[model samples]
Target chain A: MIERDVIVKGDAGVHARPAMMLVKEAMKYPCQVMLIKDDVEADCKSIMSVLGLAIVSGSRLIIRADGEGDAQAVNSIVSMIEHNFKPHEESAEKN
Target chain B: MANNRVQLKDFLGDTGIIDLQIRLVAGSTGITREIHVGDINRPGLTLAGFYDFFAYDRIQIFGLGETAYLHQLSEPEKKEVLEKFFSYDVLCCIFTHNEEPDSLFMEYADAKGVPIFITKKDTTKFTSSLVYLLNEAFAPSVTLHGTFVDVYGIGVLLMGKSGVGKSECALELVERGHRFIADDVVILKRIDESILMGSGAPMLKHHMEIRGLGIINVKDIFGIRSVRDRKRVELVVILEEWEQGKEYDRLGLEDQTHAILDIDVPSIMVPVRPGRNIPIIVETAALNQRLKKQGIFTARELDRNIRESLKRENKEE
Candidate 1:
């Protein structure tokens, strides 16, 4: 299992669009991913569960993943938030 | 499960389920204070200065008896008792039977940040309702992604991966005259040690999202009889894609259970395929669950009869 804490830095926080992105990213890995905000833990793969956490700017979030490639899965998601959920770098490089 | 303390504001303003018929009389600033326990304390003994084992944490109920006693006390005595009463950090105070608290008590409560409320309901009626509502509010709850329906008077929760036809199955069941409780997100609350009640999220109740049809309101499309606000979760039906080689339960001899919030709920898995009619199967599962509840096991009874007949035939031979 791997865990990393990241603060939501995006000005809009994690609304529906960001929550969808988070779920999309978490579903790519086979590992079980969870987002812990306050004391509530939400399944990262489920959009409803992630949105229900009501994450806001400056909110502390702990991304925890278990199973194969758990470390890379956690880091990928942590970096997404740390970068303010920017578009994929490859797509940005295309422009 | 963790107990969620009921906020004083929610308790006072809630008019739907448990109506305490209470109105704020004093200490408006303290309305935000939380009521930790569901039980109420009469505080008759504490008023007489016997403060030993005083349950100061609960909401103090000043009934007719306590109100009359306070009215009879002299100025200095009343002041002394009121001071001691407010010193313990009482959650709140309620005067039942439309009784009013004296100025001294109100002053003490307001200064101490302890809210004071008065109810037209008598002591017995008001306390009973308050305790019941508080316990329900404090009950532990969890949310899941599924559709809950009442088929043949049994609560059937349909769960599966998104787009696996849970919502479609529930819609078909509703069309067949079953009641739809919730779709998409189901909020389940443990009412007691044995019973788990399931309801729809407040915002998403009576709504269904089909794969191609988008979102549709079940209640608006169907009549009121087709929708229920809540029901006890009696059975769980898990719908998954049909795997060619995976062994399925053919005999119904083994009891399968899924745990939610540490409680085991009876569950069954139903594979989905193009030719299979999932709604009818779910409806049958619900009826079977009802029979089991009534102490009738059809599969076991049939197996027992067959075994007895085979043994008798062997003996005769």
Candidate 2:
């Protein structure tokens, strides 16, 4: 299993929307993904299981992905959470 | 695409349809026909032998004028026009103001497997309402992780990392007498170019799942006035865990915006800490937005005052 530490930077801590976003991002890979916050571990594939953990901002999560393409899956998930789960960057506003 | 098809069954029991007073006049068996276009066509010109620019795939709306004109036509002429009209693949026909078409027209529609819907609303009302419903139904939408609340007449959307107390802050606002729109999952729809409407997702409506506490319904626990069905999003407040030595916008001079879909919304980042009263900060932020809308900028005013005082002191020196 490939593992990486990710910090939740989303202005809003990982809640229902971010949890669903993480779950969806995890589902794109053909591997087993898990997020561990403190001692609690959550399966990234199940929306309910991930949301149940209630991991918040600044919280460090050790993501473990096993099976084929585990490295790629772990990298993408790490970026997804670190990037505040934004699908795209918001162009800075010129005041 | 305009050719994208939606079933009539999907639109039947929608909240907007209830006001439409819609009923199945004929062809209930053909309820599965695809509703191709979000736009509606009156089809009066098409009925009058003008087929060059006919949008037959659109939902056909027959008003009093169109119905009256059809009645004016001779039986054979009407039959010929309708037969030709039904020949092309169209979504369905909607008759407004409970206006019943000629019985012969119904037979043609039934035979052609065209669904017909009758509404008590007049042509103008039905057209406006239907257009709104269709646009909203097919609008590009996204579900966001945030709590929507109305603070001092301003819609404040609270967003942050998971387990960052977003819901807790929203609950605090709810207890402070502000109307709560949605907790956990906020479904946002771009109703127009500039307007975005925020509503609670159906599964977790009126509910907040706190870490220590399992689940709490704000509407039931608080009162009806404490919660709302939806609100027009005006300001976005993002809560983040406070980091030592990290620079934050203390002066609030630079305007920040968060883009969802193609629309840009005003946003502010509030760092969360043990002693910080986030709900109060959110309230003040919303109030500040209300003031901004009214052409008042407190920070700019303060800056101006500081400049004037500094200039006076320089002259004195």
Candidate 3:
């Protein structure tokens, strides 16, 4: 398994929108993905489980992925988090 | 560090006791007197009374009833109690109760350099929990000759002399879908009365240095699920080099156990030889241990089968 420490940078943190985006990205791979904070472990694909963590901005978390496609899954999730989950920041601002 | 000694002045007010000597106050004016409360002759005395009799290193005050009752004693009675409290070899006092102690008691405690703490739990609940915690915290532990490995779906601790293939066996176990808990130096912590947990040191976490392969990161190479932070040690597998003259237990008849922190854990000794499948044997050993825990003993069953066969031969004769 590959594990990396990630800090939430999105303005809304891991709220409903970001959580849904994360879950959708997690579902693309066939590996077991988990986000851990302190002693609590949450499945990355479960929206309820991720939301229950109340992961706010500046909170640090450990992202772990196991099985096939683990590397791709870790890289994709980290990229999404780093990019602030903003696919069309320019277009949204104009609207 | 010597100054760290909790003085009564910290707990009680500065002028709670005039002379500051440990002496019981008796009579109307609180005449100071020295009394031994631990003695049977002086029964019904408070915790302070018992401390006077026995020079205990520490005093654990289990607050059963009202804490205010302690202050209800007359001035002389209170002085007598304080004298016992100061004279005893008490290091610290723990009070268990949701209620607060009397202000005068606090003053005396601070003046006498006694350390006092209050917990929200009741006396009975506090005593039970404290005893449990202390037993585990103070249990004896020792470093053993072993390499703990995460076998296929099991935690197998490999033990043997230096160069007895312990590390080699662990390397193979990791390649076979099992994770690695700790290699070489495994630090064990006593979690509870009956449990001992094992974890790798910070420098060695997720990094295993094999003799032939050098250093390798298990997490980076295998992935996250292939490594664990800690694991509850379940079985101890000792690997001994094969000796021609030595007798080996081929039938697992005798029961073996390894004692760790006063708890007996199931143990197995496997003979190592050229071309032998050590990893597979170790995996079987783990599975066998799990089955044994479920009350199914394979060794005992084999022994029973042999006995039945012997009985049949005798009847035929």
Compared with the true structure, model 1 gives a TM-score of: 0.85
RMSD of each: 3.5, 11.6, 16.8
Q: For model 1, how big is the CA root-mean-square deviation?
A: 3.5
Error of 3 at A17 (Å): 49
Extract clashing residue pairs from model 1: none
| Candidate number achieving the greatest DockQ relative to the actual structure | 1
Error of 1 at B224 (Å): 5.8
Q: Which residue runs does candidate 2 get wrong by more than 4 Å?
A: A1-95, B1-6, B13-18, B312-317
lDDT of 3 by residue, B1-317 (tens): 00112232322222221221212111112111121221111112444455344534433453654355565778778767766655654444556665555666666656655555566667666566545433433444444446788775567778876568877787788788788877655656566666877766554567665555755777898888778877778888889999889987777867788887777778888889899999999998888877887889887887889999999999999
DockQ of candidate 2 against the true complex: 0.04
**Order of models, best lDDT first:** 1, 2, 3
In model 3, the fraction of reference contacts reproduced equals 0.00
The weakest ten consecutive residues by lDDT in model 3 chain B span B24-33
- Per-residue lDDT tens digits for candidate 2, residues B83-158, read 8988898678999878988798789778877888888889998899888878877766776667899999888889
Give the per-residue lDDT of model 1 (tens digit) for B1-317.
Answer: 32375688897765467778899988888898887776779999999989998999898999999999999999998998898888788888999999989877888888988889999999998888987787677778887888899999999999998778898899999999999998767888887787888987665568776766756789999989999998999899999999999999999988899887667889999999998999999989999999999988888999999999999999999
User: Residue B114 lDDT in model 3?
Assistant: 55
Candidate 2, residue B193: lDDT = 88
Question: Ranking by DockQ, best first?
Answer: 1, 2, 3
- Pick by TM-score: which candidate is best? 1
